[model samples]
Target chain A: MSTNVWNGEHRRIHMQEVGTRDGLQAECAFVDTQDKIALVNALSDSGVAKIEVTAFVSPQAIPALRDAEIVMREIERKPGVVYTALVPNVRGAERAIDARADELNLVMSASESHNLANLRMTQAQSFGALKQVASLARASKLPVDISLSCAFGCPMEGDVSEATVLHWSQRLIEEAGARGITLCDTTGMAYPSQVARLTAMFIEHWPHTELTLHFHNTRGMGLANVLAAIDAGANRFDASLGGIGGCPYAPGASGNVCSEEIVHALECMGYDTGVDLAALIAASKRLPALIGHETPSQIVKAGRRLDLHPLPADFAAIRERALQRDAASAEPRG
Target chain B: MSTNVWNGEHRRIHMQEVGTRDGLQAECAFVDTQDKIALVNALSDSGVAKIEVTAFVSPQAIPALRDAEIVMREIERKPGVVYTALVPNVRGAERAIDARADELNLVMSASESHNLANLRMTQAQSFGALKQVASLARASKLPVDISLSCAFGCPMEGDVSEATVLHWSQRLIEEAGARGITLCDTTGMAYPSQVARLTAMFIEHWPHTELTLHFHNTRGMGLANVLAAIDAGANRFDASLGGIGGCPYAPGASGNVCSEEIVHALECMGYDTGVDLAALIAASKRLPALIGHETPSQIVKAGRRLDLHPLPADFAAIRERALQRDAASAEPRG
Candidate 1:
């Protein structure tokens, strides 16, 4: 009944391409450090506000990103594009700072079961580690961004309580002074209502902190969650190219929300994302080769809505070629 | 910054399963008549408000639905479910009535290029035909539902004007007494804002008419458009099972939005869809055998978020084998 119902969020949205890190992290084949640089450079050219180049973790922990420093150093950081890296601990923060990362992305699962399963540490241990990383980030003059994995829900545990999310977020922000926070739907268990509720809570509590939404299309609700966040007034998002990446815990599962799909939806709705979709799409094109596999991107499978297909060469004569040629004859036997 | 942002449309939503007709129409294989009956019967039992059983076009028009009458005659329809049939012309309407189809779904593209290219007729000719069908439907006591294909945009002609959509809808309701209308994103060109604007306008003008949205996931915005429509106060939708039904015009392109995906989203957001998701999912499982191919349904690929996988057989040994092997490895990195 009201026109103002859906346009609550009409401001410019910012996208952070995390394909080079989050997307390729769990892949079996090791992408050449040179290819990773190329991907990051291309994504940087797309006018994204941030590019998460790589994760600085133990080489044995994630063999896919063993050359984290190589990628962070090799990428040509464009002006205005913040080059960030995923740091799991103090050691990661040191490496990211050494590589001159503009921001340090520290992650911890909000769910206790996932925190143990994913990081081999309790939530308290993760908080302790993050506290240390936060101090180092402040000393190095780099912003510390926190991502609460499984904030929506967990695979090991069915539902992560909102109380748990709010409590951890308060610790991560109030105690650690995180410059930004991402409430990640790690395995895509998020629905719109949950996203709206949590986003509203976060925005209300920490009005000054940059709130980014990180969603996986594991259940095909990734873009849907993005829409919900937009309505709830969130601006920053983390997305993967070509929808690559899978949880090492759950192989054959989808990774992050496809960056192309997110930007495409926003741009279509007249929202200025400041990212060049054509350039981002061009970057997504190279993902299959870089990752050595076909992608799950819908834009790749189904061209842009404006991309018109040529009419049939025999459009005038094709009516007789329809599959229902015998339907008349099959009708109730005269 | 307020919680009153997105809770605008909290109401009952209805799902119409169009898989048996729209999904199978463009398939290469002709499903067995018995399978069609079984599929319809299963969907009926799933608590869906409507089931589009088959199209009554000339068997010559779509040979895939050659057994429309037989399938319609044999399937056990549920008491509350409305078994609808697609009718292309007067002859199709006659057969649909004979087969006891409760509703007749008549369609014509809004864009003239799509109308001619898809239906092989001009817009005015389609209007004339629909006029005749509408009068017949009134006489036979069957509701005439008109679908304006490519109402959002057309693959052949690009953006169909909003003025054209409103004009045709006005005539269909005022002149033909059409009971319901469907705004079809035939090629998945619809974005959220466009859907919101059009839905709001339709709701404003035809306050009492049943406005249903038909979207294709061609560009991964099908569910997003559904969200926008919901925000704009539309409660009815048409979705295909297993995400079947590719566009013949754009070969290999996705067809209607997956029914499971739509219902999953609505049910997750606390809207009462009335249909049982587990039952719908179980019915969707039989589609591969019935259609002789794998489907694009995400729930099948990723499973529900609540469907947890068992922890690995080597869970204890695997954690000690994490990629980040050392908490002390980051002690200033030497």
Candidate 2:
């Protein structure tokens, strides 16, 4: 196997922040353009390898991300940090190119039902549209990546087969000339064995392509799936700040894997997730006020694992009392 | 090396429900004795291997569990399920023995500071008292298990070494003749690598003893740690319904790993957890009204992964329109 990732050997892990695009797109309330810009800038300062900055889809479809062009253009891009924007069609691709995005993320779903319900198109149509967008981006010399939603299991159609996922991935990579593919667990149905199996298969098939694993914590298996993917040799992951983001279609489902939570776990496991957890957590703490609700970030709520709490106010007295009791119990009479 | 738990090999996993003891112990409001007995009865029908029914500590110390004796007596003990009770000293052990508890779980912290702050005694005092409890339980032919709190890390002291944990476990297992041991991530400070290392060592040292893992979701690493422990050969886990229970001393920390969430994941991963998940979830859904607060259970909120959502209302019409649009586009439109 590919040098078991858990053999006490730490390696560099590339974390991509997707809260701005995937997370914001699902929110009902529109975040101000300036706040979005500020969030992106803060993430740029953190050491995430990439940021899915925004989506260039029709504003009518995702009013929450209507200020995508402005966000893409106004943010002060950091060197070495890839800024990607979601594009649903050639028009969105043109907009992303105009906004100077570093990469174009073409979107579609692996499951036909999800693709139809989500994109208002069939899987064939989605591939045809995304292929054109990929060609357009390629002509503009911008790297294009495909995000296959419901790759693991569809909320409407349970258990999308591994063969189906690979078939779609093959077409996306070979036919569309995509540089990377992210298998999105849209409703967090992925288990560890399934993740390991698919990750290993995908890596074996596309050894050189950038393969990212995107998971949702809807079922509380997000971090476990991440560990499984890492064990199977997939490094890149998409995480959201404050764990804010869920499938708008799946009510009661939790958001994306919490960015700070996953980073803390990876760092503790000896992986070098270049991002500064303190800076990221500081940014995450701002989400409750900014989003007008609480996000599901455990690390944000509990602080880092090592963030020590002060002993009880009467700790000295308690210790003194215990010591006295211990001494008394050890007395000759006793 | 231990057959790789994720090698697609299915096995039976033993799940222990600890909501009544560990979960309710930290709750401020008192769940009535009748309600406690009903909760335990519900879990008994859910196919869990064990239920930590109640704690036999002094009622003055934990008024939330003041009805422990009544709860223990009234819980209609299921034949196959082992009913366990937490005992802090000889008096508690005697009470548990009188209640006809199937197992006596003696608890103490691995860290000196946490032991003093939490149990109001030094580690030596806690151990001495627990040793007596174990011997008393042994004399009564009741199985004894020791839960080493802060086995992963302590909130006040931080990073309780594996060496410290193993040392205490050795003393409890060898000196006290304990039959089982639980390594508790009392503060949710465990990461996967740390769990893997410690579990392997613990299993290696005490191959014949039943090793149970108790984890908190304080940092969102609870389930991930569970996966790691399983990979390292641990089969028993302590989980709570509704994910209730946290370190009262560490405010803001999340509760124990959600029993339904973990069972759902394990069942999905092909492991026969022996849990009737639908029944377990039914019981978990009762937590909000019963406990008078919302729980942190993702499975209870999101439903099981295969609990499919119905297709959108206009899905047929949408698919028709997409198919018509695809035909038009393919016909070489001018």
Candidate 3:
């Protein structure tokens, strides 16, 4: 049995900011293209290393990203910042390439049932489409990352076997020529042990493929799964600011794990994710109004751990006096 | 250098419900004694192994728990359920004993500044008083547990040393004769590394003492810390239903780890906590109105992982039709 150890500095984990696309897409209200650009720019300024700017699906399917081209065009691109776009197929990849996106992300559900329901395609068809997208991206000298959605477990299929996930992952990396694979707890059915087991198996099989984790706080094991993955030697992660973006098909599927929360968790564990939490929270303040609903992120409401609220100067003195009185009264005399 | 291994059937960590005490104490509105009693009875009926019913402190300090004596008396104590009370001093222990509390929980701050600020006494004085209370509890033949608040780190004094926590913990177990020790992330400053180190140290020194963890989600590390503690050999935990409770003095301190969230995390990992999550969520329905604020717990808002909302019968047909359309569009060569 391996024991958990604290070597302090060796505990750092990476965080991916998904606020711009995942967060805004779930909003009931239409965030104007300007506001979307502002939100993306704010997150970029907050020192996030990478931001999932937008998805390139058909405009009719998701009207929220109809201005994806415009928003991508208007945003100020910072040096050293990686801008990624989520593409559903070759058509989406073409738009992303035209928009000059730094990275392209493609996803397909591991469970065949979910894939048909979510993407209007079978698993084989989705993989075929991904291979074409990967070839196109590679031709243009762009990086392509494949995300295996519902890798842990699926809502419709119940428990997903590890062999299924590994089989798809291997096919994607080998045939599609993808650079990295992200295992998503799309329905938040992952337990820590499942995470450790699946992650270990994946790492053992694809020793060279970079692994990232995408989790939902739907069951409140988002961070637990992250820790388990980290322990299994997977470090990269994808999180939405304020935990935005739930699967429209999966009921009770809340957004991706909160970006600020993940950054705070990583930083506290001595991991250098290069994201400023206070700035991230500041960027998240525009979300409630923009999304037309209250956010689910805890740090936005409670403030950061080190955030000190200003108290009345006399408050401490008054409390001290009360303590003194209590001490005197409670002291036993000989 | 230890890697986490996935051993299926690892016993699920036990959860000690503190909703009645810690959850209720932080609310401004006073729940009537009968209502408090009803809540406790409901929790007891829900099959939790232990429930912290109330805290015996001065009414002037915490008026919310003023009717601790009446509430404890009226509870319909279930068989095998350990009813615990949070006692601040010898007088509090006397009252708890009078009320027939199954267990007396003594609290002391691990940080000197927090100890002085919270208890109105130095560490030595608090330890001395705890010894007296332990002696009385032993004479009365009641079980005793010690909770070291701010054991991980403190808001007033950042980065509480591991040596200090272990030293005070040993003192409490040895000198005060505590049957168990609970380390609290009072300000939620504990990272996974810190939790692993402190819990390992405590377990190493006081091998026989039962170690419980009480973590706040203030920094969003509550559940992460719990996983680390579990890996460090801790089995007992203190969680509030719907993640209730906050520290009045600590500005950003908010909500204890949610019971439903923790239960979901454990059960999904194949550990058996023996608590029904749906029933727990049902029991927490009154929490919003009782606290007069919406809780931050995800399970309370989004429901469980497998919880499926009633779907329209047309949903499946609509998805199937969409898939057929896509497949027809793809058949070009024929």
Best by TM-score: 2
Residue range B38-134, candidate 1, lDDT tens digits:
8899899899999999999888879999999999888997898999999999999999899999999999889877777777766777888899998
lDDT of 2 by residue, B95-186 (tens): 98998899999989999999998899989888888888888888999999999999999989999988899999999999988899999988
Count of clashing pairs, candidate 3: 1
Badly placed stretches (over 4 Å) of model 3 are A1-12, A45-47, A247-254, A277-282, A285-294, A308-334, B1-8, B249-254, B286-294, B309-312, B319-334
**TM-scores across all candidates?**
0.92, 0.97, 0.90
Which pairs of residues collide in model 3? A12-A271
- Looking at model 2, the pairs that clash are none
Which is the winner by DockQ between candidate 1 and candidate 2?
A: 2
Candidate 3 lDDT, B1-334, residue by residue in tens: 2334233265856789998899888888898888788788878877777899999999999999999999988899799889999999889999999999999999989987777677766677788889999999999999899999988777777677888988888899887899988898887777887787788778888889988999988767787888788778788899998788876654444568889888877777666787877788877887777677776577877667676544345658856776786778889966
Each candidate's DockQ? 0.36, 0.75, 0.42
Per-residue alpha-carbon lDDT of candidate 3 for residues A1-334, written as tens digits (9 for 90 to 100):
2333233264556667887887777766788899999999998898887789999989888888889998887889999788999999899999999999999999999988778777767787789889999999999999999999889777777778998999999899988998889898887777778888888899899989878888887767787778777777787888998888886644444568888888777777777677877789898888888888777777787666666544345556756775686688789965
Error of 1 at B41 (Å): 0.7
fnat, candidate 1? 0.57
Q: Give per-residue CA lDDT, model 1, range A169-228, as digits (tens).
A: 999999999999989888889888889889988898889999999998876778888877
| Predicted structure 1, TM vs. truth | 0.92
